[model samples]
Target: MTFDHYGIGHGFDRPGFGEAYFQAQGISAIHVMGRGDDWYQYADMDAAMATVRAATEGAVRVVTYGSSMGGYGALRFADAAGATDALALSPQYSLDPKVAAHERRWSQDFRRIRWRPDSNGPISCSARAVVVYDPIGPDRWHGERIAQDIACHLIRLPYTAHPVTTYLSDAGLLGPLIAGLLDGDFDPQAFRREARRNRSANGIYLGELAASQPRRRVATALSLARRALDVSPGNWHAQVSLARLLSQEGRHDEALSILAVLVQQSDRSLTYVVDLGNAFLHAGLTTEARAIADEVLSRAGDVAHLHAWAAHICWLNGDVADARRLIRRAVTLDAGNRVYLRAIIDYHFGAPYIAGVRGVRVTSWLRLARWMMKAPLRPEPAEAVRRPFPFRRRQDDSASDSAG
Candidate 1:
């Protein structure tokens, strides 16, 4: 059985993570999906477990596997489903503020979850467990916590960072490694050698590594980005990295040239659009930035971040009234976003970047500052910005379906 990661889906009928790959191999598998970013902490979780248990009954050997949030789910339900082995890739030990307070990456989702006792508790399993994570990444803390809870083998992929599975997959190691692990013939030394050899060809790894380079080593970063593009031309992330680096070097035309194609090819992806808009703004092309905002807003409504982006563009273009209106809309959509709130306060009372404004309404500004201090530092959910789950069915669809 496999469980899905965070933001993978809100419903089923669409394939769960690894569903297609397992199906193509003629392997019997069941997928446990969660609604929204709930982290499988559904109100009917016990019932969902019952379904999984019933489906796995009399199985010769059961293995639960998943990555990230899915990884957590695999370990969480291993004992309940009578699994012999649980394989988790970049799994969390807990998302509860009290249990894993140091985990700030997924705070937005954490706040949304009404944590039950079982939801974010330590893993307790008789099953043989293996956890894969980047020791240098935030997931190291999570992997360590899982180790503290139970006896489990920890596979540390140093510098691979969070979503280590993506790195492995990009390096053409995931399928083979997973197969070897499941079949009990996995060799860590061999895997590491292959990964090391393939790392240069992995676009995600290359781009991230490039982005992580210090300012003084920007030449090296640019070289790495170009190498990423050279090896993986279709990788938009690599392209974006290259573009951003060019922009950093004041190569505006070159940056715009790269982003222009990306923005066109991305089917108006808000993320890419925002990047392009920011690139324009950075290049002192306010007219182009305004045009991009206008085109996006004409079609893209109900998204907090889009409004925020548009508001920012408008503010820089000296349209304070529209900026204020748009920013307020953004705050209304996502009250917890500190960035949007800060922008609101900045727009009304003038920030450091905006010039020629006397400190007007000092008392109101103080009140807003106090409110900002109390606000949760949460990013707006992707669901709020994009139609992530196009085939969102009934909430109970996964629970009701018979396991494969």
Candidate 2:
């Protein structure tokens, strides 16, 4: 049976599962009715559950599923009817007091009952329950607290809008509900395991966002990372993740501030140091970035990626020769690393450096050439070239080659 806000009870008609859900689960003999009404009203949910319970003769196994306002109704029904199980998707714990206060202007029906959490009808079910919500919802905190209190399994679907029922067909949504029903246990441990698994599956959705145009959606990623931090303030991964996103958005100062707090509370982590360097580099503070890279290298000298970042700092500081040398070292340490190889190639063949050489207009490039001639190139078995050579040939070499 399906229910709606109106008092119309209609035969349930979800093409995929309305009948199949009952038939496959051995619930075919039971009668299903859709109770369409405001279940929050005093006599509404009580009357409906009474009818269903009586019809099923106390042997009924009621599984209630609801979304949005309907979700609230389902919970009320579960509490009153002693349902076998319940599932509420994107439910509001209570109507916002601000909205309820404006009931007169919005709708006359809104004023028919109190909408505060305290005034809402109590849930009285002994049945196991599941509450699914989107963390970005306006009532997210209220929903989370309610789920926590009831010990209902909470499934946080990332990037979902206000009501998640629209995603009823989503595999990530249906697969778990089916699994939970079959398992017949909804204890805390089970909930935790399911939550973790769901989080792993949700990672695919994040990968899609990461692959979006403009390279990154810093705002969306940072918002989710912030939500994770709010849920678990001590989550080090969330904090670092937020910092990384902030750095991508060019909010380096904010990223640095977050990292500063995180590093103080924890040991010197490699991720923290690398992120700090990135933040500094994005903020146009090459010297500060180099200092961080130096500190990281002191402890992790052989880490090729760290050396590559340090080379970038050197390049930004107008030490092109040193930048090239450090980049070459980084590449030698990790030959298969495309990131370091790209940096090396950039230093060697990038348009700016090549243009400076062709135009003969950059004093820094001339100085770099002189320094390169004096410094010995580090020998590498993989290197095709053996030694550093001058950019211009000597007058004697030109005359001798001409004569020959």
Candidate 3:
């Protein structure tokens, strides 16, 4: 079933995956698509359930399948719609916060869910429920809440994140797995064995493992990241993570060698170029680093991040005058931000850099002072910046904590 589509990732099939395979097996599938907080508790619930009843009238069994938010819906609606089995990948017991107080991963989505129609409560289904999860993944934290009342057959695929369906899709095993469950012939060991063999799954698992590790364990983390790159060399996320870890370990030359190719291949993505510049600067190649900043400034329209990166690089190369000018340009581009204003003050500027302003406005300076009072997450892996943080691109998708 399709979950809420508000913040979908790349390659997510809006209709759900696997039509040909399901048809080949003579298994007809019904996709229940939800908008916002309907939770499959859609306004047309009665009609939808009646439709399901009509469709499964003579069928031997019915299985409801979904992952993440869809998993949340499938399990909750399974019994209501007379399903004989539910295959929930990374199901949440609730987004209500009241029932699932310990859960915290998808708090943003949680606020979007309706409070009255709670999905965390005990389900009425008499059929078997199968929950596939990564025990160490954040999904497990939510999955366990429903386990207290429901006797679910758990298949732990550790290190697989919330999107276990991606792994299932890659392995071409979703149809077979569901068929097995419906036929009472489900084999967890065989299924796990088959799913683990998928190259995409391995790449995801290794990359996630490397990313989740602490920086203090740099050597081991680097080894895992390298393994991930071996599995999926074209994965940009792994490339950045490896380069950053390498740079952190003072192996800047190695980082530069790896990132140089990526910078050109990526068509000078600001993130890659910034990372490349960072590598060159750290590796005692300031001239090459400065050239990269100059190239970005020369080619593009007014991009706040490009100017920010150029400013940082200029400051490093003892071009304080250019650094001051670039910082002023960055601040001009993002006017409302007090963070940038304080940077101007830190640059020893008495007046606001804008030509029309009389001086650094007292009110703006006060706003900057207020901003300094709070501890904010920034210049770190977790902070998704628009301008040049020299890390991940904060695209129109969900941000990850360790995407750097």
Best by lDDT: 1
Off by over 4 Å in 1: 135-137, 158-162, 264-269, 290-307, 337-339, 352-404
Any runs in candidate 2 off by more than 4 Å, and if so which? Answer: 1-26, 29-44, 58-61, 96-122, 165-168, 172-176, 186-404
**Residue lDDT tens for model 2, 190-303:** 544554455533433333233232445566666566665665466555577677777878888888999988877778777677778878888898888878877888886655
Of 1 and 2, the candidate ranking higher by lDDT = 1
Q: Give the TM-score of candidate 3.
A: 0.58
TM-score of each: 0.78, 0.40, 0.58
lDDT of 3 by residue, 1-404 (tens): 22332233324354443445567778677766554433454467667767876877777788877777777766777876777888888777666767776655544445445565544577655667888877786677666766766788777777665567655654467768877987878887888777776644365677668777886887789888898788778766567768877887899877888898888789888668878877887777777889888977887536665676687677677777787778767665654344454555645433334324545455555655665565355554555534322123346523322111
Poorest lDDT segment (10 consecutive residues) of candidate 3 = 1-10
Per-candidate Cα lDDT values, in order, are: 0.78, 0.57, 0.66
**Candidate number with the higher TM-score (1 or 2):** 1
**Superposed Cα deviation of residue 51, candidate 1 (Å):** 1.8
